[model samples]
Target: MESPPSVEIISSSFIKPKFISEEANKPVYLSPWDLAMMSTHYIQKGLLYALPKTQDFSITAFLDDLKHSLSDTLTHFYPLAARLSTVKQQNPPSFTMFIDPNNSPGARFIHSSVNLTIAGILTPTDVPITVQSFFDHHKAISHDGTKLSLLSVQVTELIDGIFIGCSVNHMVADGSSFWHFFNSWSEVFRSGTITRPPVTKRWVPPGPDPIITLPFASGDEVIERPNYPLGLRVRIFHFSSDSLAKLKAKVNSECNTSKISTLQALAALVWRCMTRARRLLPEQETTCGMAADNRKRLSPPLPETYFGTSLHSVKATTTAGKLLHHSNAWAAWRLHQSVVNHDDKVVQEFVNSWLEKPLVYTMSRYFDASCVHIGSSPRFDMYGNKFNLGNGLAVLSGYANKFDGKVTVYPGRESGGSMDLEICMLSKNMKAFESDEEFMSVVTY
Candidate 1:
């Protein structure tokens, strides 16, 4: 590990909007299961880069200063950073929630800090500099500040570039919320003032209100047969423009099908592709878990100020053979049925009931169970138009972990009569997808 920069703090302050006032009304405690679910994803890192040579800021100091500056915003979302602070051992067991349960909630966000490291890059000039790695090296599995470290001194280099990696708990904030924090941090650093207001609406803790829970389970499948991976896998491929055009045209023109979104068509194709990869029989049901942003879809559009958690998941299934047999028309219709009006109560109930069952005993039993976790956000294209991260800079994207054979399908360019499809799958599945002439021809132009 490398040390952080030695930079002076100009001025740093959080922009807490009027909407977040209510969420601060009380400290919320998530179930140990929810915290564990959140912690698992923290292992999947989100990274971005910064190239600021003129500023007196060192990568190390910038991170240290930023961590101190953003303490207010950090405390506001205490559950995310602090909850993982109590870990005593490396990658502690599931039952051990990280943060000290008895610690005052006020101490929550304040404990969070930014760490740094240095990696060499190919460059013409000879400069030695360090980079900021926000995550704790020791607390790879937990979220403790001490486990988290700071480079004792400033780091400088010839390249004049730094990479910032964020390991925030997804349960605390999605990419959207995370971007808001980033933009605010940039604003405070650049101008020494919090110019823009908080992007999140006031937080509303879901009261004993009857509603859905996350990680919606279906069947006794997840529990009855927990499929642990026999080995790790990776694959990659580039979808050409021509191939995407032809596929969209075929799916759009399929009989008995009206206009179908590229997402649905791609989802079907991905399921088919995964089935092909596993060589599953058409009669066997395969599930692709889809992630949805319930923001606008939720009634009253869920408070803009309300932050906490604001998304949910839905699962759809079909026999591999049955899906394979379908013409574009039938598959599109089936895909539409699974996702359209997903906000409806019936769909929510369908997902929640499956997860509520006490299946710890069952979930522990299986390994190598096949599942495709799919998440695609239309917002990825919009460069912070609404969230307003400053300087016209935004990283508008999110994805499920490469584990569990995930697929993310979102809107693509309009080709022929349909929009282009962007499909991201685990590396291995991607290779299988690219080699499938049938799959490639239809989607490409």
Candidate 2:
């Protein structure tokens, strides 16, 4: 086995917004949806780009440009450059995210270099464990927002490429907002401006009270620091557009339903395959949860630029026997129904229930060996984030919030309907899944 690359940190500093206004300094109230994510891990993701061919390429100049663009970008997305404040002395403990211009709580900017090539990191079947080092705040959860920076960016220079890793508090932003900020940063880097300015005003669901407070007396009571599991393997599986279309066609034809989407079909396929690989008892129950964006599901749908955490986990469950005995179309139909049923009414009910009693998303609440939870979306324009460098070679997730059944979906670098599944599972189950003929047949990796 090859030795892991050594990463040396050259500098660690905070990048504040270039400018701030009175309106920008106002405290942003946390909604029930935001509070629910307090215990979850930060969203750690990054882009890898090959180095430019010019001989005059200067690392110092490139780093300077990145910092300046980030500072300018934070002017619009000011919340990211701020900190989460908690007041335990209040009646119910007031929790709000505030930007203190005097304190200037800026986002952490880290510059580092690795002694390895990009191929050394990407060519392997399993993502190198060291890749997690490319990100910051590995031990910090969203609840730590009271003191920690809400967002952290680490730029690690490679032998012939660079990796820009970003870690954002999950309570402050979901995958949509994470990518929105990333795309905006890249736009600022290339043109010194953004085409679609972010809508920083958070959306509040209709309820008796717009601001919801948690039942806890202090933020520390809700903080959870769970040790990451061991003996888990992570691998990326590529499914080409043709393969995806064929899978979708097969399932739709079998069920005589044209409403099953490619993503639904793919999720069903993974759920069934993982169940089979686990060799669970026939009578045992299995669940598949997919993160659904609620922006469009509301009555007065939120704007595309509505920037905050708006994701709800829509789940489908069935007996292991039924999932395996039934055809792929059957499973796909189940998943399709779960997503379809999560409409405006269901979204409202969820928000109301959450408002009545706010609950933080601890690891135990959502993860299990018998369940598979899918996060992120393939619809994100990942490859389009070209910060003067050419298009990205790959997109990767970090070690935070990952477990045996976590699966993250990303658009393939080629980007014509191709999809990549970053799957994490127990070593034994991963071995079985790799050997499964049906699953391997469609995997282009």
Candidate 3:
């Protein structure tokens, strides 16, 4: 086996936004979700983009541009450049939040170059795809309750392309907030200004609503982290348009009811296959959890461009044998129904359910082996965010998923109807998972 590509940091600097006023340093209160997220130093979300060739933008020139644009963009998105911590008090505090000060620490930006190319690594060949090796691994997930830089950008120059990886703290922003900053930064990179200004203030509950609380005592956190360290494996699975359609049609037929979305069908298929691989009991309760974006779904809706975590998670649960024994459609319908249940009334109820209590969520925190999480929506332009590079986006992957049974979905590299599944599982489960004939039948790559 060959070693994966390595990243050598050429230059590391702190880029403080040019516009942060003294008042911008005022302590910022954290949302309930923020506190819950801080409990486990869950690995930061990573994005690897292979940029097209550029004649004018040399590796140095590109890094120069990235640094300047990112700094400018962070001005409007200042909280990103701020630190995630609690107000220091002699008596200790109940909640942790962002520490703000004029000279507070800024995001860490590293300029790196790798002796690899997008073609060599991304395209499968003799060696298996060890994508996690080519990313900013340690700085992203190594949290010991100190040094809370909200964002870290590592721009590596590859032989034939540019490898851009972002390690963003979940408490800093969820998918919505992360993408909002990304889009604005891209706009600043290409157009010198952003179109949609950010709405950084958080959304609060209605009048008379009780204050929400969350447990955040680090080591004693209720996070569903692995009880013991286990070696993990990462693999990329592809689903072609034709195969997805056929599976969707078959699912709808078996469901014997109204149609469900392709995502639901896909989730059900993967969940069932994984459940069968685990060989859980017929009565064992297994869950499939997916997050719902509440940008526009919640009452009154969030701002036109809310730059914070606004995700509401919903799960479909069933007995292991019950889910496995039924037709794929039955499982698909369960997934769809879970999403359907995230209605306006349920959205409010979700908030109320966490009042004066811990804000528990299912993502990387599902403690048991019976849980399977459906990650990053396929609807997200994961691979389509163009940097205005000539050849455009060639591929996209979240590269650093460490949790077992967690799958992150992305758009296929080639185009329409194609999908990429990055499945992270323990070595044992992953070994058995790859050989599962039922899953291999529909996979295109």
Candidate 4:
């Protein structure tokens, strides 16, 4: 990433906004029905790299400039500064809140230091190994506010390679919204003003009245825990377009189906892989859930411009006997039906139930479950544009999902004419699928 020229910060007119208070705003209670989707752990972060155009590039200079521009832009987004709050004992409704540093809603922390290392520059490395890391590495979940570590700035070059790594927090934004924010940020830096305004449409989380009955009793009912280490492994698979087409053809032929998006196909393929991985002694079934953004499904479709946490979830389950022997197309067709039926109310209802559950209780159920999976759409324009920082553009966001012992799928490169799909599963699951010649053929294709 090319560093920007230094500019004077004379006559600063910066003023940070304060988070909303219970005294000022009404407390919205969570219901039990909202729990299905809300019980999972949610942590998002991103690593954006500005690939180099020329071998000659400077890291320190580029990051210093990016920080200046970013800080200025973030000053306008107040949610980053706000803290989380829930209703206390419901009489007239009072908020029970603990302003934890990690849970703060608004711009909680900024990158405090910069760490840089270059690897595989002159080596026989075939692909760029973007080893992006985060700051405030050690964060403990606390009820009370605690000072947290911040990644003030990070800029690194890989030996003779050209790329700068940038990572950011999830509370600030999701992948799609953050990408929009970054595009605007880049536009502002280049044009001195954003060409497009941010999406400001309000997302009505499950309404406050009727007290959405969540599945759980209270927040105390849901359990939250860090993901198990080494239990899950992450890998990226790129399929040749021809192979993708052949697989799609096979799926269509086997299922007597029409064109199905690669995502739906992969979901079916993954479900089969995981269920078959169990090497079961008896027939069993498991649920597979997909994260659907209902921003466009509301009575009034949510503003594409509206920014906030706007998402709904849908789940599908397959009996071990059915998935184990089902043709790829058959499972894919069933999976597609389940996802299409997921709507805003379903999502909101799930969230309500999630919020009402005791954290511990929810966590335990999640950990004990044999089948659970959730992932987002790869709909954003990530690898399309080249962001030139006198070097190259890099992608960034907060989806550090370690799919521990679960089946997960996200968007990948295009397969056929549809969006390509990225599928992740536990290592054991991967091995199991690979062991099945037929299953492996379906996936590898």
Candidate 5:
């Protein structure tokens, strides 16, 4: 049998911000929402771009320019270069993030190379597990920010392409912020400036005590390495614009309502198909948890450039029998209601509950044979990150934070409202899901 691919480390170093300010060095208290993700894994994702075809194209020059732009980018996104510090001395430990200019704490940058082709990485029926090697901090969780770099980047030089992998502490940023930093880096790389600067001021709930204290006295008490299930397989399923429109039309027609959105219809289809593929008991309960972006949902919406985690998980649930027996529109309506109901009031209420008793997210929270958790919005501009090499051929999720029943949605490279669902599930279930006719019907890839 052929051995899996391997990555040879060419170089590894810390890339500090080009400039720092005393204000940027001040400790910024983590909000309750940020504290909630302390136990989760770092957000790991990367973009693959075909190498430019030009006699002047020089890999060495390209990499040097990329690193220089990243340094300049960090000047604006300095918080990413900071460390997560725990105030263990406090009665109940408090967390704060700050950059120590004197110590020169910086984002970890790794340069690596792999003897593989772009097709070898993207043509497989399943996402290559070897892709995990393209990222740093595979075993590190968000809380490890105390000792680990809050942000780590690995640029892997492929035979005909380049894969830029990024791992950001989940407690420090969400999908929105992740993409913001990525886009900013690309902008700086190509144009030497950004259109909109990131808002570094972290959001705090309006109350007597803005900073919510953790129940634990030390980071050790809260840090946990979740044991994900074994024998899992991940595959990307593509849904074209026409396919999405057809799905939305079918569900809305069946329900005689136009309220179900394309996302709702798509979620409903996955929820029902996975339930059938699992072959669960008829009466067993099934749940679909969707990560709702609360930036706009909150009253007096935060800036689009807000640089921190701002997400809430909303769930729609029903018995497996009911889910399978119901019309596609019925399931879509359930998901639609769950998402639309998460308004400002709900967001604030969840914050209040977290303040009363902080609860860090664990993989087990959503790990269940009967549960599906969907994250990463399809609305994110996955294909627009050019960085002078042109649009990405594909966007990939790393092995970190992966568990059975986890589904991450990304906009297709083809754009025009198309979407790609990166689904992770047990090997057995994946085999069944791949053979599922209804699910495969809309899948373009």
Candidate 6:
């Protein structure tokens, strides 16, 4: 493997929101959903942009514009400038947690650069870039509870373009809220105005506090990152529109249903292929934990711009051999059914079912060796954001999802039906997976 590139940080400062409502200046409690992620890793979402190639580039001006616009953008996203705090009521016990807006510390704004260029990071041939480079190296964001700011922004200037990255507290929001903030940032920077005013109304699930009862790890408990069955690897694959159409057709025809969705087909294909590559025994059970957006599904639909988490994490299970040896359509049908069944009521039930357990929903407990965790989704229109700085945003590298046996799906760079699939797994499994004939048939690596 090649050595990681070097990056330099020139300056750093906190960017405060230009305006704050009187109500937003107080402490905001974490809903049951927010409590579920208290002990987990923060979600780091990175955007790689190929800025409009300019013969003359002004670093000073660029930094000023970015910082100024970001400050303005924060006006509508005041919670991001807030800090996390734990409340204590007694000795052997705990108290409800809340976001202390009164103690809000402005978000960190970093201006950095790397020796490399956009072309060097994204190749015309194989994998453009590994997200670990952004998450692990040149790290400017910290998620530790010690950090006062719940959000951080790092803008790296490459030779030809720029890389815009944001680190956000998962406790404050999920993937939906994460992107919503970014889209708003881009809009403000490009046009000096926010097209979508952020909605801060958090979804308070109908449940008691300390959402999940599963036993959370004690402060001393240590869970090492997964690196077994040979070291791990992360790779990105592009699936063209034609390929998705083919899978959709294959699934629809075999299942005798015309409503089979693209996501269902893709999920089934990846799950089956991964299980086959692992060569699990017939009786060995494998599972998939997927994140579902429960926004519109709620009885009183969540506002399109509701700026909080509405993710209802759900799972599906079956024996390894059954998933692989069974008809592709069968697996696809199962996946489709699983999602279809997880309606609004099921979303609430998912939360209610977990209210009795300790907060075991930490990242360490999210996925096991036998299960694959699928987060991120094609539904997020990532490329739609016009990062006014570029020669038309060329490619979106991706967010950093460090865990093994994980997959994140983003909108394809090409047509509407396409997809950019990022798969992270053991190195041995990746090699076996890359060689899998069925998987490679429709994928462009």
TM-score of each: 0.60, 0.97, 0.86, 0.69, 0.96, 0.89
Give the Å shift of residue 100 in candidate 2. 6.1
True-vs-predicted CA distance for residue 155, candidate 1, Å: 12
* Number of the top lDDT candidate: 2
**Residue-by-residue lDDT tens digits, candidate 1, 1-445:** 5453432322322222122344444334433223323332332222223355355755556555555545544434433333333222233222222232123232211112223222332221212222222232312322222233211111122233333334455444554555555555455545545544443333333457322233322211222222323343432222454554555566778743556765666666766766676667667877766666655655557544344445555566678787677765566566666667676474346335534542221222221235566654534432222111122211212222334455443233222233323343344555665678666555443
C-alpha local distance difference test of each model:
0.41, 0.87, 0.68, 0.45, 0.87, 0.71
Q: Compose the digit string of candidate 5's lDDT tens values, residues 1-445.
A: 7988799999998988888877677777788788878888899999999989988998888888888999999999998888877554475455443323335459999999998899998899998878889999987888888888989999999899999999998988999999999989988998999998999888999878655566676666666787757899999999999999999999999988899989889999999999999999999999998898999998999999999999998899999999999887899999999999999999999988887877878776556779998899888876778878888999997778888889999998888999999999999889999899999999998
Query: Model 4, 1-445: lDDT tens per residue?
Result: 7432221211212222333433323322222322232333333333334345565755555554555555555544433333434435555433333222234333433322222322332122111223323322222222111232112223333333333233333322444565566566565555546555555323434454534332333444443544544544444444455655677677777777676666667667766666667564336767666667666766667677654445544667767787777687887777778777776566556555545552322334543335656565656654432335432222322223444444333334342333333334556665665577655564443
lDDT of 3 by residue, 233-327 (tens): 66678899888888888888877765698888988888999988887899999988887777777877778588767776679999998998887
Poorly placed runs, candidate 5 (over 4 Å): 90-104
Q: What ranges in model 1 sit over 4 Å off?
A: 1-25, 31-39, 43-45, 50-57, 75-81, 84-161, 179-231, 235-249, 255-259, 347-369, 381-400, 408-431, 439-445
RMSDs, each prediction? 9.3, 1.6, 3.5, 7.5, 1.6, 3.3
Candidates sorted by lDDT, best first: 2, 5, 6, 3, 4, 1
True-structure Cα RMSD, model 2: 1.6
User: Per-residue lDDT for 1-445 in model 6, tens only?
Assistant: 7766767778888888888878678766666667666555566767677766576867778778888888899889888888866544445444555677765568888787777866676664334444334432122222244355688787787777777777787778888888888888878888889877877866665545522222332322322322223365667788988888998999899989997788888888888888888878899989877788887877777888888767776677899978877887888887777778888788677666656553535444566667777788887757766666543344343333455678888878765788887787777677888889998997965
What pairs collide in candidate 3?
A: none
For candidate 1, give the lDDT of residue 374. 62
Candidate 3 minimal-lDDT segment of 10 residues: 137-146
Candidate 4 off by > 4 Å: 1-42, 45-56, 85-132, 135-172, 200-202, 205-223, 253-259, 344-363, 367-369, 372-374, 384-386, 389-400, 405-426, 434-436, 439-445
Question: The CA-based lDDT of model 2 is what?
Answer: 0.87
lDDT at position 55, candidate 3: 56
